[model samples]
Target: MANFHVYAAGTGSDVQHPTIRRIGVSDVLDALRLGFEDFWDKPSHYVFLGLIYPIVGVVLITWTSGGNALQLIYPLMTGFALLGPIAAIGLYEISRRRELNLDTSWWHALEVRNSPAMPAIVVVGIMLMALFVVWIVTAHTLYARVYDDAVPLSIGAFVSDVLTTQRGWTLIILGNLIGLLFALIALSTTVVAFPLLLDRDIGAYAAIETSARAIMANPVPMLFWGLIVAVALLIGSLPLLVGLAIVLPVLGHATWHLYRKVIEPAPAPVPVKAARSRKRSN
Candidate 1:
């Protein structure tokens, strides 16, 4: 993350006031580098949990196979990445512990289970799940709407239709537009909220508000960061999702660093002389 002081202005007299900051593209890249460093430092902590992603991927692929099922397959597999932020709760903890020079073992990493933020995190998790559910429903509706007369039951038939037909082209354009809407909402609300929840005792709504403010303050860099996340997760899912063992942890850790960059820490109180003069100074 960039120097905290640059963005650490006090929003109010309250100590816990969230201070949003603007960041550049370089800070985003730096966050990733730090994320990789954290991952390598404690590779063992993530290995077992990372293994689970592949198993989940395999299960999802198998469950969504066949002809008509093809349409759902792409969204279901990629859209699950929408939940990657919440799922990486453990990773954020690991990164936090590492940054503080605290214990970063399996026990400390999963400490989110007992965190004060658990209740709020649960609410946020449900919100993310809702977004994912909506995407799935929308995708299914789009597929059915596109192929009104008949259904394609095989992969080849499905592929041929989408590639060679005007209806397929329309579905592609419209489905992606709808999918993009869901993705942007997911990205804006949770990009920094999960990490903020893990770090503070604040409620979910507060964390989400702070995350939104952070993005709005740095719209350009946040947009670039969002694209990086979407592309990385998509690529990671391509190779039977075996790449997620490395990809998910890295992104999770990087998100913590990025959050640090965008959400300024509360500034120290003004000196006695300045405090008196600023009472009505807005």
Candidate 2:
């Protein structure tokens, strides 16, 4: 058997040690389906937390409509982006702990806010914001170049025009292609890396490398998992943003399960003297 140990943090003497266990593709799919069922069964919990989606959406729409909205919305956006992952960490922990028949709470999950994993959360938030900025800037630049108008084209117009143009088609295809690549990277690592950091007290780099190695070692299963996530996200985007609430939470929960499956901590080493002594005694 391939044995490994993962050093986890905040695990009190009373808590069990975190270990990496072998997992399979069927396990990943089951976890995803279970997470969705859990969400559906307890819609109230998500509904309360998910209100932020629509509220943020409204604020963003208002901001786009030419209000001095940044004053109010920018901070909200940043906070939402930063805190969203932190919040998801708790859900992840809860799901795992629940599976183990351990006690867990929203408060416990919230503790991830102060954990070392925060850096990874913050980095992801920054990347998301950067992507949003790039998309906005590209749309505006294209509009300016195409229409020869100084005023920024509305997001709706930009999207519509791009969808209709050859350039737009190219951009769309290219964007999906790039997205697929990143999704593979993300699928391989993000699930295991973030929670592993929280549980292991390890740095993000080590967690990421460990995750990558796990992916490399199990390419077929990881590829299948990545494709599943990509397809789900694509479907989610079809309904505009509403699909995000369900898709995002389900993905978040499913990802926690995937992490559990892919990462197997190295096993503790047996002492050579103990082995020789045992053989002699036998």
User: Best-fitting candidate, measured by TM-score?
Assistant: 1
- Which tens-of-lDDT digit does each residue in 74-101 have in candidate 1? 7888688888887789989988888888
Local distance difference test, each candidate: 0.81, 0.57
Q: Give the worst 10-residue stretch by lDDT in candidate 1.
A: 1-10
Candidate 2: clashing pairs of residues: 3-267, 4-265, 4-266, 4-267, 5-265, 5-266, 8-199, 8-200, 90-109
**Model 2 per-residue lDDT tens digits across residues 113-166:** 766556655554455456555544544444445545434355556667657987
RMSD to the hidden true structure, all candidates: 6.5, 7.7
Structural similarity to truth (TM-score) of each candidate: 0.86, 0.65
- For model 1, the stretches where C-alpha displacement exceeds 4 angstroms are 1-17, 66-68, 266-282
